[model samples]
Target: TQLLEQSPQFLSIQEGENLTVYCNSSSVFSSLQWYRQEPGEGPVLLVTVVTGGEVKKLKRLTFQFGDARKDSSLHITAAQPGDTGLYLCAGPTNTGNQFYFGTGTSLTVIP
Candidate 1:
């Protein structure tokens, strides 16, 4: 079963553009993590949003956790070619026993 669903599975944009991708799930989670994976490499953790309705910013990237703690969004500002990669959101099950990863959003930032 798919625990997490990510919107806009495929995205292609020009440099200096902005974009937002979403991750949603029915079950509530205590915390959620966002990751970015480049071609032929492992995913690197971007940030972990723990509290409900929390917003975190890393450079030009922004992450927001839903007020209900069941959804999240990632927004990128001033996209660059170096930003091209797959963005994935992951979280633990309600019981905190297992983890689930979103289907992912593929981002292509053309120079």
Candidate 2:
């Protein structure tokens, strides 16, 4: 079953602007992870927000998990061209044997 959904499948913004991408699901997760994939390399883990209502920042990128642990958001401030990539969120299945990933949001930042 499709467990995770991400919004705005695609996004393009000018440099220095801010943007937010969302990930939602009907099921609650024990922990949620965000990843960013560049052109060729594999998706790199950005952050893992475990607790509901928790927020974490990685430089200009900010990540937050919903209070119910069923949603999450990634916000970037003063977005730069280097931030262009495909953002994805993943959560382990109830069985804890595998992970379900979001559809993905491809972001392009114009310089």
Candidate 3:
């Protein structure tokens, strides 16, 4: 089974600061998705990338897929305290429709 991996497992930054998080995998997926999760709520999908080198922006956040389609990144410009949450990247596995999630990144944006 293939697995997704994330870097900088934990991040703490002050408000108005910028930060970047990464997700990587050796296996290529049909599509990759990014999610933001709060303490007690299910993850909310932020963006999905299906094409290699595709880039998407939402407000102050930018999402990018690697040219090889085996990696992804999220960058936040002037992060706010409300942005604190767990970031996850997920993609379907080789077998069936099962999806695998990355080793999550915990972000704490201090006000």
Candidate 4:
């Protein structure tokens, strides 16, 4: 089974600040994806990176896939209070049918 891990499980920052969250694994994946969720709501897909070294940007948020496909990162610029949420990274496991999600990063952007 492929296992995914995230670093700095939690983060709190003031509005207009910037932050980066990382997701890592020893197992290579076919694709990597990022999501953000708010309380009492389901996670929302932000972006998906399918190729090594791929980068996708959604407004002030940027997503990247490592060259080896074993890691990924999400960077948020000029964060807003609305950005406060749970961030997650996920990818298909070796089984292909199952997916593995990182521990997650809880970000609180204070106004």
Candidate 1 or 4, higher lDDT? 1
Clashing pairs in 1: none
lDDT per residue for candidate 2 within 1-111, as digits (tens), equals 568999889999999999999999999999999999999889999999999999999999999999999999999999999999999999998788999999999999999
Q: What is the lDDT of candidate 3?
A: 0.93
TM-score of 4: 0.94
Question: Which ten-residue region of model 2 has the weakest summed lDDT?
Answer: 1-10
User: What are the lDDT scores of the predictions, listed in order?
Assistant: 0.96, 0.96, 0.93, 0.92
TM-score, cand. 2 vs. native: 0.96
lDDT of 3 by residue, 4-66 (tens): 999889999999999999999998888889999999999999999889999999999999999
For candidate 4, give the lDDT. Answer: 0.92
Best by TM-score: 2
lDDT of 4 by residue, 82-107 (tens): 99999999998667798788899999
In terms of lDDT, the poorest run of 10 residues in model 1 is 91-100
lDDT of 1 at 100: 96
**Model 1 agreement with the true structure over 1-111: per-residue lDDT tens digits:** 788999999999999999999999998989999999999999999999999999999999999999999999999999999999999999987688888999999999999
Model 2, residue 26: what's the lDDT?
95
Tally clashing residue pairs in candidate 1: 0
TM-score of each: 0.96, 0.96, 0.94, 0.94
Q: Assess the local accuracy of residue 105 in candidate 1 as a C-alpha lDDT between 0 and 100.
A: 98
